[model samples]
Target: MNLYQVAKTVVYGALSPIYRFDVHGTEDFPKEGGVLVCSNHIHALDPPVVGILAPRPVHFMAKEELFNAPILKTLIPKLNAFPVKRGMSDREAMRKAIQLLKDGNVVGLFPEGTRSKDGVLKEGLAGAGFFALRGDAVVIPTAIVGPYKPFKRLKVIYGKPMDMTPFREQRASADVVTAAIMAEIQKLLDAHK
Candidate 1:
């Protein structure tokens, strides 16, 4: 495990009860090899919950500004977290994610591109779809519910993996395809609610 991941695991474990994490559908995660994990963005807390409870380590994208603090700069990269520019496509970030997939590691994505304002799943951007198609990796759909009241139980559901082969050679309308993926995320969230 990466050093930052180790630290994150330790910290999250200590705080798990405070957050009341309750995870489900973990069995849906592949036992081995690389996979693309896409999930709904409900809150900033979502990534920690998913990363901590997941059967495998998941690398995710975070806004670049979050790493500006000196401590975070050192910690974030080690935790498998990378920076992405908010308003523009960060090609370098995408390459890093793809490289991780090539190295047989799970890369987590928030296809909606940003957190949901009202905790409802929104339309996803095309960035995630393009990565899945290019990497030809299994896409694991996921959803996170609740950061509700104080110490309320948070639910995280991992759906089945999606094969991108059929859409591989298709056109580059990543946004269009991402909408389909986001729909699955919404369904999972609804089921758990």
Candidate 2:
């Protein structure tokens, strides 16, 4: 296995026992092809945790600020993460994500744009929807609960793929698609609660 895959396996192995990590609906994850894995951002741990649990490798759009760190600058990219400027359209980042999707890579995104400091679900931004529409990717809604503290049970639930064909056919606006994604995420969260 490659270094990244080895690292992911090690991390997942190490964290699983300590955090009592649980994953559901992994069978629903697409084994191949471009797919958008959308999740509710509750903690910084969300991306790596979800990425490691996924059946395939996942590339995440992390805030550009994180890349400023010397270690992260080198490490993040190795982990298949790219910087994205928050509070802006960030067309370059979008293009990069789309290209990855077009190349049949699973891209992980938090539709909320930022983490929920209070652990409450926030309204999603249009980026996830945009990527989904642009790449013609299937959206997989994932919900992560807990791992807030050491030894706490952490659950990751993967919902079924959300087809974008209808939205595309109707020429649905970004806001409409985003709302639909967010609603599905909320449902996954509530189901796990």
Candidate 3:
């Protein structure tokens, strides 16, 4: 296993008991090729949870501020995370994400951009769809219920891979693509309810 895989395994092993972790639809994960794992951002733990629980090693685009901290600067990269400037399209970060996807790696993204304090799925940004289109990656919609209380079940539901080929062929706008992805995510969340 690579360092990132080892780290993910260890982290998942350690956190599994502390929080009642349950995963569904792991079989839906792509065994090979470029994949974009998109999900709603609930808690700060969402990224780590997705990264660890996923069948493949997933790289994330974390907020740039997180990388500025000395400890995280060193540790986050080891966990396969790159920095992205929020509220703006950070082209450099986007390029990195696209390259990772092109290399046939799974890339994790929170379409809501930031964690929702109220636990509601916010409107998604177009960035996820952009990467999925540019890299021709399969978009996997994911839903994370909660890690609210200790020993309480934190559910993660993975939906089927969303084929972006049609959307790309249609030359769909970012807003249209984002809406489609959000709709899929909403379905997963509704199922969880």
Candidate 4:
């Protein structure tokens, strides 16, 4: 198996037994094309949860500081994670994400930029929006709801791609797309909760 498949298997093996994951809307995820998987950040497990539930492998953007650790620096890239410098514009990371999407790969990220610490949703950031536009990706609005307790159900829903046609015609800014993406996620959260 490929490294991504191997790691996914290991993570699934570890998490599946501990948490009962109730996933829905897998059909909403497109089988092909550049897809931007945008979601709300709730817990540290959010990324992996989305990654595992996704029908395809996901390329994740992690904070640059994570790459400072020796083992993580060695291991993270193999798992399809790239580092982004926080609190500043990191053009290199953006370019990488755009390239991945343009190549028809699925790039997943939490638009809130950090963990919420509490289960409450945080304000969205514009990076995900920019990535979607620049990569010409179909932005898939996804949501994960959890305070993550053992044996409690962890819910993940992948909503349909946000209709970017209007936005594209209007030449919408990344900030505008960010707002729409966040609102859709909120709806998914409310429905599932």
| Model 1 lDDT per residue over 1-193, tens place | 6685687679787777687777788887888777888998888777777787788888988889979987998778878899988898789988988888877888898888778889877888888888887765788899888864558887788899887776765664777668768878888987898
Write out the backbone clash pairs for model 3.
none
Q: Candidates' lDDT values, in order?
A: 0.81, 0.89, 0.89, 0.88
List where candidate 4 sits over 4 angstroms from the true fold.
none
Error in Å for residue 106 of model 4: 0.6
Tens-place lDDT per residue, model 2, 123-177, is 9988778888888689999898884678888999999999999999999988899
State, as a TM-score between 0 and 1, how close model 2 is to the true structure. Answer: 0.93
| Decoy 1 TM-score against native | 0.90
As for TM-score, the candidate ahead, 2 or 4, is: 4
lDDT of 3 by residue, 73-183 (tens): 888888889998977868999999999998999999998888899888899987877887898789999999885688899999989999999999999987788889999
Sort by TM-score, best first: what order?
4, 3, 2, 1
lDDT per residue as tens, model 4, 67-108: 999899989999999999988999999999999999999999
TM-score of each: 0.90, 0.93, 0.94, 0.95
Residue 20, candidate 3: C-alpha displacement in angstroms? 1.2
Once superposed on the true structure, which residue ranges of model 2 sit more than 4 Å away at CA? Answer: none
Model 3: residues with Cα > 4 Å off, grouped in runs: none
